[model samples]
Target: MNRHGQRIGEPASRWRMQIVPIATVMIASALPLMLPLVASSPVLPPLGLLFFLSWQLLRTEMWPVWIGLPLGLWDDLFSGAPIGTAIALWTAASIAIAYLSQRIYWRGFLHDWAIGALLVAAVQALAVFITFPHAPAGHMLGLVLPQIIISVLLMPLFLRLTGKFDNFRLKRR
Candidate 1:
């Protein structure tokens, strides 16, 4: 073998691979608070959902179905949402993605983006409803529209971020 050659069969640490993606998404749940300052309105996108979608779409088999339970619990703690909100939503999204992946073998960037956008919008809608249950429908949607738009726009970035993190996680060490 050449000096620069790598052992083809050797793999990176399994523990690292398992932890990196999940840990990153859990951390992403706290991203809004990590911003330099708080905004007056709910402007920050739902980042935890974005990261979860990225990992599921970009590397479909990397996570198990039950993975969402713990991940969502972590998100709920940081998100000021009801304790079970993220848990329910994240688990549902996980199951949905897993189901879709099994039936639809063809997935491209645009396909993933469309899926992410829909999921994000749905999650955002639910969040708004839960937060402002008594508010008018139009007002509830207005509160979350910017957030939904930002999350949709950030889909590509999170997808790229997931790709990079996946590479880092699997890099031979």
Candidate 2:
């Protein structure tokens, strides 16, 4: 008890967890830049988007509607995609998730996974559309499909990891 007589090792309240998401999202946005680019298949799971969704779904109260713009701009700078593409998509996804959370009370791993899949697919589709104007539609689909599948399959893992991070953030001495 530093001052308030609270236990030293107790976890923080939900209100204190707000900074975790924004910091985590910012860090995640920069991750792809550190990865070694493969010439054969340029597709990699979108870790930034995955973490953003994970934070939003796991702790809906912490995510503000306007958080997406700066985070998306960060992603656009590093992701090599056109400027404003991620800004629009991330903001839209956040709004959609906010709406869904308001309307639906029941949420499970499967439901979260499905929503993640749809969102990831949408982002990937738009990425292909914006980045590869000259490529054939069939080719774009073939390329993006793998990344989408990988991102979807990894959602649970990302969620678990996000939870762990939250735990770490809230943990006391």
* Number of the top TM-score candidate: 1
Worst 10 residues of 1 by lDDT: 1-10
Once fitted onto the true fold, the runs of candidate 1 whose alpha carbons sit more than 4 angstroms away are 1-6
* CA lDDT scores, all candidates in order: 0.86, 0.84
Tens digits of per-residue lDDT, candidate 2, 9-84, equal 7767655466777777878878878877765655678889999999888877776887789999999998889898
Residue pairs with colliding backbones in model 1 are: none
Scored by Cα lDDT, where does model 2 land?
A: 0.84
lDDT of 1 by residue, 1-173 (tens): 33656676678988888889988898899987778876767888878889998998888788888788998899999999888888888888888899999988988889899988998899879877876788899987887798899999999999999999999999876
Flag regions of model 2 displaced more than 4 Å: 2-16
Residue pairs clashing in model 2 are none
